[model samples]
Target: MNNKEKADEYFSKNKSKIKDSDRPVYHFTPDIGWMNDPNGFSYFNGEYHLFYQYNPYDIKWGPMHWGHAKTRDFVNWDRLPVALAPDDEIKGQCFSGTAITDNDKHILVYTVHSNDKEEQTVEIGDGVNYKAVSDKPVIGIDKLPKGFGGVDFRDPKIWKEDNVYYCIASAKNDRGFGSILLFESKDLLEWKYVGILFENDGKYGKMWECPDFFKLGNKYVLVISVMGMQARKRKYFNGHQVIYFVGTYDKSSYKFIPNGRGKTFDFGFDFYAPQSLYAGGRTLSVAWLHDWSNDLTLDGAKWCGQTTFPRELKLEGNDIYQMPAGELESHYKNKYHTSFILNRNKEYIDNDLNSRTARFDFDIENIDADKLTLFLAANDEYNSFIKINMKKKTLKFSRRFSGLCKDAIDERKIDIDICDGQLSLSVLVDRFSIEIFVNKGKEVLTSRIYTPLDANEIRFLADGKLKIDVSKNEIE
Candidate 1:
């Protein structure tokens, strides 16, 4: 079958297996279909607006549309109409872009992906990337300025500074170095090139997707997810990731100070393709939590990817920390678990083993043990383990569950240590992704592990006398 036919077939098989939970601790496949890079994230007029790459025609990834949703509060989301669909001459799809309110009116600017049936790469000046509509494409390639390497550019993220609109998009150079193209637009329409941000000088690996620029505390941060790098060569590599550099932006020179190397936003296997929007005096970021490499689960799970909960990015002495938005606590049902202690080393004996979709805040005061392993979905032979290696002062996590068809048995490891007076963690597990927020979102580890549709057994254990209070919250 052709690409379209294969996509439709994939969608039909996993339609029922897809999970779109309304509760706060659940997973959701977008109402329409495939979704990628979170776009146009803004809180306007007392409402939270979120748009993502969507393919309504099928469940599989393809030419995207701006799938839209809004909420008075983050809890109760209302799926709105498809904000931007393919209405332009760009043949293949609407790739990805950001949106902003242009003078009290909601206006969207996105990268339009056009693939000629005969040509592998179409010239941006020849025809591609214009405004799009649901029924048809908008504008023509001829309307754009006639210069710059065009086909390798898209994913526009526009922001305003000192009354001027600035956008940063991803592009490749004539020498094959991946870089960000900068543009200046006064009325959101016509544009002028404003020097490339960081040239693909072979230092940053390769192509950057969903480039975003914002200010946090005293530092200006440039964040982008890079692709085509391997795990051993990089710090964290599942597929793409949200990596960034902190520097100073000079408006007069229109340049960013080259800082040190970029760092991974979250040291997790699942987090990637992250984008950010600045509002409410804080910079909030979100990312797709599934890998583009080794995409073996897409056929079995139906839905392809998921996004981490909104995080507030803060810079503390040259290091970036991600904390979940405080407003999310409003969705907690207040149902918490108190009494909790450890018994045997192999099996969990006490505490609460109920409520599959919930949150856990754990505080351990004192504990003596060679190893402390907490189980999330534990059974006779297989279980997901979050082990604290007291000997190494490290916490390692890995998972094993129902569907085990993938090549690797599906495991992840990270070095996390306790801080301050205690260590805190917030766990959110849907059917697919397990997001661990360590120490009040200071350190987050996101992973995609396939568990049986019904594997919901959780327990905890410590090597010695473990004094800890675990609060489990059920969300409405």
Candidate 2:
């Protein structure tokens, strides 16, 4: 079947298995299609609005459009009509962009694709960037930029500080180094080209997708997800990773002072395309929780893509730590189960599948082994599976689906390790993605995997010798 058909079939088979359809956990996949990039995240009039890159046409990847959804409490979401869809003149479709509220209007600046129509040739003009205005998106494709480089030059991130709007976009150079192009707008219409903020020096990767620029505390954080970067020292994959550079931004020169070097935000097998928004007094981040290299079972179930939990970011000394947002605790009303331990061994514990969603915690201290493995099953015996292995100082994950009658476990991995003192790991396993935070976001691992929802089994194993405390919280 085609991708649309496949997605429909997949959603039909597994929609019921999704956790808290009425109230969503920080981790869950789009019900029928694909979603990426957290957009238009703002709390206005006591409501939280979240827009994203969505392609409803397929369970797998395809032409992307702006998908809209909102929540009053950030837990129960109501899907709204798509904010932006590609009109005929646009070549392939809508590309990534950001949404900002200006005065009364919600101004959205996005890159529109005309690549397919404009043949790939130097002779052809660059692609176009447009402004999507919505008092209801009725006006449609309000304003566009003058030289667009096909669809490749897309994903606009917009922000305003003193009333003037600024945007940063991802562009590929002739030599293929991913770069960020800067622009300034007065009325959110006409944009003046500013100098390039940063570019890949063959250090990180080729293409930088979803570049988010924001201020945290007294420092600036430039977050970008890239594809095709080799590990300089430590990393699991040869392609696709998210890295960040924490520095100070000088608006006068429009340059950022490098505090040190760039590093991977999460040292896991999966985690890419992270976007941050300043909410309350803290800067909260949510990322697309899947990688290009791993299969999300979209082929079998047809639905795909997931978002990591809201992480509260803070600048600690010279490093940043990400912890689950405090608001997320509101979901713990039901409290199906909880576990705690000061010290332990092969402490294998299991809890009833009381609720569809859960928050699992492990406090680990004392390390003597070269490797450690923690497995979760629906039962105490055999079969049902979700395995997390810390081998050679790397964190790895694997799982088996309930529908697929395969004895072989499908391995979907994210590698991360702890530093200095004791390490605490929190895992949120929904229908699709597994969002793991190590040592309170020192290294996070977000991977999209498909497993039987009913397979509510959890197991813990240590390779050598270590002390671990475990707790599981089910959503009310």
Candidate 3:
């Protein structure tokens, strides 16, 4: 049988084994096996297609294939057949890359990583069915630019500019530093090297994995996931983390001049390798919502890994703000609103505000408290809390007591400026993830939790009296 037939058979056999309790209601999780590094997030033929690194037979990472899903509004998703698989003759894995709509065909550009040679080769495919345009690499190791000699090249992100296609791929320099290489293609078949776009000066990390470059408003943004960086004094733990550089791109010279130091894309523990697509006149991005250090408890669960809710990227000054895609508001229902004042040393637990999937909007003013806390996914044994300190102007997410599977990186904190002594926040809670938007998305945090499925209580606490207006909406 062909690769498509094999994938269909494997998915059919294991799809029934997935535990319903472990799956997310709104987030995109594979029907079976393991998934990571969201690849090819793009819109083609009136549908949004999302592909990822997939292994169909197990809950752990293995032989890679491109798992596929499509959505019309970014809320409801349809899992399609697997798109790409490693050919028998390739003797390697199909790694991460991007997709684009070219000449009415879905073009997939990805890396064929061969562990035997410790090198990578680029390949492209056409149509929804990924038939390789060529069996050999269009751009190989011999074509790489100078100063880049490491074997860590992968994850090509492609975009079109004034009828010419540009590709930015992650690479490693001869000295083991992370870098991004630029390539230009006219017909999506042959590619020419266009100098190095940017590289780490030893301050970021050793190797970069996924690199995405795009224009948000007037400035150009480059997002990448860096590996082997230390976690000391950072919001994320030591391992793979995603960061973005806001800068200006000189299209004439193909040069990128960053404005300042790169900033953390998501001030959370579980976001990485985010890829964006231009849809509905906005840039929407999704990421792998699992961390590297967490232990997998997949003894009976047939599937693992999920993608974050699609976020709309907006640029305000040098900072990027992420809000849930506007289409997602259609899924919200059962709106509840309340206003209250919590005195010092008081804790309010709202048992009625129970939902495994919900959206919360909080407008807090008249601040007389040093600290304010909100608990979500709360139950008798598990709960995650978002703590905000007025004096320090910081927000911290703590999941230490949320459930089992304890790790040292269960908590993440970041400093933010509270605007006008008031806090406006929005929180989206899915089954296994929580996305917190603080001060109208000025600073956003995305976290993944393993709390119990029945943990649906909401609680509020304060150190002193404060007035707040809270609204909750259950998402269908």
Best by lDDT: 3
- TM per model? 0.83, 0.79, 0.96
TM value for model 3: 0.96
Name every residue pair that clashes in candidate 1: 87-133, 87-136, 87-137, 88-136, 88-137, 88-138
lDDT of 1 by residue, 17-49 (tens): 545542224443465456777777776666767
- Model 3 residue 117 CA deviation (Å) reads 4.8
What is the lDDT, from 0 to 100, of the residue 308 in candidate 1? 72
Tens-place lDDT per residue, model 2, 321-366, is 8877777777775454444332234555545433336777777765
lDDT score of residue 362 within candidate 1: 73
Model 3 C-alpha lDDT per residue in residues 1-476, reported as the tens digit of each score? 86656977999886777776668877888888889889989888788999999998888988888898888876777888888787675556889999888767787878887773323344344435666666666667776888766377888888787888888888878898878888898866778988778888887878888899999999999998988766656544467788889999887777888999888888777888999998779999999988676764445678889998999999998889998888778888888888899888878976667787988999987467999998889977889999989888888899888775655467888888886668898998998888899888877788788787788988888999888888898887
Model 1: residues with Cα > 4 Å off, grouped in runs? 1-28, 88-92, 116-148, 232-234, 296-303, 339-346, 351-353, 402-405, 419-422
Residue 29 in candidate 2 has what lDDT? 49
Off by over 4 Å in 3: 19-21, 117-127, 232-237, 406-408
Model 2 TM-score (2 dp): 0.79
